[model samples]
Target: MARSGNEQVSYRRAPNFLTANEPEKRLDIRLSYKSFRALEEQALTLYGISPVEYSATDSRVTIYTAPTALHGYSAVNLQQAISFAVYNILVQHQKQELFERIVAVGESTYSSVNDQGRRSTKTPDAGLSYYYDGGTVLTIIMEVGASEGYTHLNADILLWMNEFHCRTAILFYNKECPKFKFPGNADTYSINDRPALEHTWFGTLDTAVLEVFKRDQNTDTCKMVVQGGSLDIGLTIGDVLPPNEDAIQDIRGERVHLRINFVRNMLASGSHDTAVSRFNHFIGED
Candidate 1:
């Protein structure tokens, strides 16, 4: 019996003709295990730490500092640790709360028109969103690293803020990077009836400042007000940057995974209260 080498393998088009022929456009996006795991690996490898730094509890993942690494833990690391921990907690709670998955986007899903009616898309560094059955809603976006001149950055945040009507953006900075210094921390500045950018700082570089983005379209203004710093910014930012090949090698020692079980458990455990708390937490009202 002779079998054609290529014929042996059967190739057929997608089962659904409508969806198969449809143009591939970005819609309500979701995360694949590959994408999520890659990001976690990237984060750990880029940050000059081992994944082992994260310790998983029943419903939370706690991050610990590597014993040999100097520079002490920084706010950046602390924020990352908390985020990772909560991520796992959320995962475990997904079934109960209907929070199926979490995702990260490379850009913001928004567009705008100028006074002349010219349209343009708004983008962010990296976005984190939670997925439900019907669709996906943005949960958080991490603007990986930024230098000075973040004034325009507020506009992008404004677009997201207006769309979701929620806050909670996390921005990270390299320890040696230059950033604006406000006279005080978490001060709100207003412009044209909307919030303008606020100023904040960490003790050193590699800080992650959680900002609340507020936009007032009626007044045509956007503001990003700083909230607080995390625990491990110093250690990560100071040592890890431009994450070179050597840096990745140093980070391969351990694997750090987010334990979002607790957060998810809480969400799944209840509804009215959990929903309210989540919405409030996103807006920083709670």
Candidate 2:
């Protein structure tokens, strides 16, 4: 209800399928980006604070608040899934030019002008960039929603596309239930303690819907790239690569994919193969 910075956001959001939290930071407060940037360094290096994002247009700095260790698992897997695919493509081609042009910028902050022409800064869970003449030309930003619903997360996807001029964004909409109470500073929430309810992205990361978005294409629309369970198919090699004409076409395009089954395992269910802890299943389902 109160104004913080220049914008006041709602405490709730709607669900969208094509996508896509840390935690909901209490609102009605303001902090300068410069101050945040200073804290961000110490927070990241010393406290392990991560997946923090905010725009200079506003004073609200968001932390992908970890409700459980599962959030961290989901974040890491999503980042590696894309990073490895892009890295493998570069390695297979073994092109020196490609290596120099493409930079693997994993979980880094972005400083750019906002749609309103004000300078803004934010960070993605993971990303890669294509450089020409020493500056980024094309960028791929990956965002995973855990404690948030569609509207909040999709807005992020659009920010990269509309304001940052970023292309090829990936979204993972987690299907974990959110009925459990958020574990406050007093204690750490565990996945087993998470309520077993209907699948929803309101505040958890279970299995997820994988999708891709292109900046040049309709900003509001996205195509599903992968799903969960045995039906899952990993994303194509070209899907992760830059869409620019100069980018790799990959003669083995259809032949290669970033195996969704492998990458999504840790997010899908409890397993010693990926990790020991995971969210419980639905009330009636297996």
Candidate 3:
């Protein structure tokens, strides 16, 4: 239980909520930063739920329950694929200094908000950060909206870019699982609801899009430079570099691509095609 000024709120273990595979849980209390951390601790130490995420914003808190086993497999494998590619590029260029500082912080909690409710806090689904000058900056973020909408995903990237002040954010809006049923815990998406689009280059593009939000240091703004079903583009060194350091050791212009084909293979569990197909069936079940 936590105290919020005049009101008292309790954090109970809603096992049914987790069993439902729900995405997020909202709290009306405007928890202080200390209270928020306290809630995270109790949820972890007392409840044995360590891999959860919490978001406190707009005088409320949203606790992101751990996803399904399938989601866990895909999210970890996908993040590993991207981070490995990036780290490999740094190794090739022998950027040992910057490379060491650059690390993949998967689902780590960090905040831009304070005790006074001046800002917000988040536990990124998967993210990357760099520590320098006694300060940690969220560099690259990856958010998988398994059950979220376009507007939420769209706003998330900017929050990462402007609020947490990250360099880039890769938003993967899951158009696969389009519906959410509460008490029953069933997903319903008619096959005719949102038909897939056939792209000339990618053969067929699933509604599930891959977008990259790059922030411009000069203007403190961001843009969706890469958006598609199958992303074949690479992240320029500028995209992954630490803040305020554009050119690094004569290797200013470098690009590292997270090959979608490679990611597809990585996400495919032990059984190869069968595993991949089964995974998709679970996500797109009507």
Candidate 4:
């Protein structure tokens, strides 16, 4: 029946029997190991991305953010640009062996078993993995952040060392964050007795560069370079990012470039020494 515009509306409706007791009947489904593995494989095939966490004992599957946020920065894009620049430099130097040996993986999950006999996973911001003796090893793990909360990051690095084992780990942060404290200090705790390389980026108009040299007594030398510049979306890695305010539209895009060089000497055999260096050249654009 039709009613006039001024008629009062009825506020009654039939109860929905389907949803009345649905919450009580909801099942807490847990995945099995085989099923979880199968699902993970399926996901890898479809998405080509690593699973966040795949536990076999408890058969638990957990997903986490792949490329973690960096507060006010484009962490993922910066990571990619750095990787691309490094790759290009490696290729240019004709260091095919080292080039193929070191692979850059961004936010890839790695599985491990802890001392508590629990399966765990870690996703570093970026990892430089080296392959040797039919096994893959992480050469360095890099963590970029806007803050100085190193507790979790240090714990994860230690976990990676114990589980997968690596040569070293590095931490990069904005200058505004708290300074990194060295191990054995009164205010800091050690992470497996290994000291991580900590580098800070100052976002001032003046560019800053840091160089780290690692010498293994008399056998080899490794050098790492870290350079900071102002934000410029028009320029990428290997392109000189200007430090002038006029070059940047968004301040959040401010970035740091990293490069590594390795040199090996055959002094024992009286042979010539070989050196391979990678550098990211920056050319300012108008």
**Candidate 3 global CA lDDT score:** 0.50
The Cα error of candidate 4 at residue 246, in Å, is: 47
Q: Please provide, for model 3 over 84-174, each residue's C-alpha lDDT reduced to its tens digit, 9 standing for 90 to 100.
A: 7667777787765676667778867665765577755666677777767787666778776544456665666776777677778776654
Q: Per-residue alpha-carbon lDDT of model 2 for 1-286, expressed as tens digits?
A: 0113232222122011001222233211122334334434443434333434322112122222223344456566666655555566667777435655656676676778656887777677666666665567546777766534665567778877877778667776664444333222212323554442332223444456666776656754544444333222334445445555355664425323456576657665422211222222111111
How well does candidate 2 match the true structure in TM-score terms?
0.55
* Stretches of model 4 off by over 4 angstroms after superposition: 1-93, 114-116, 132-134, 175-286
Work out the TM-score per prediction. 0.32, 0.55, 0.55, 0.34
Arranged by lDDT, best first? 3, 2, 4, 1
Q: Please write out the lDDT profile of model 1 over residues 1-286, one tens digit for every residue.
A: 0012211221112112213222121001112223334434444544454566631221121111111011112222423454464444434534223222445454444455566886554445555555555566555544433222244344445555554443444443322233222232112322232223232221224433434332322423222232232222212210111122232343322222323443223223332232233222223310
Error of 3 at 55 (Å): 31
lDDT of 4 by residue, 128-167 (tens): 5655567766555555543333344444445555565543
lDDT of 4 at 262: 11
> Highest lDDT: which candidate?
3
Deviation (Å) of 184 in candidate 2: 12
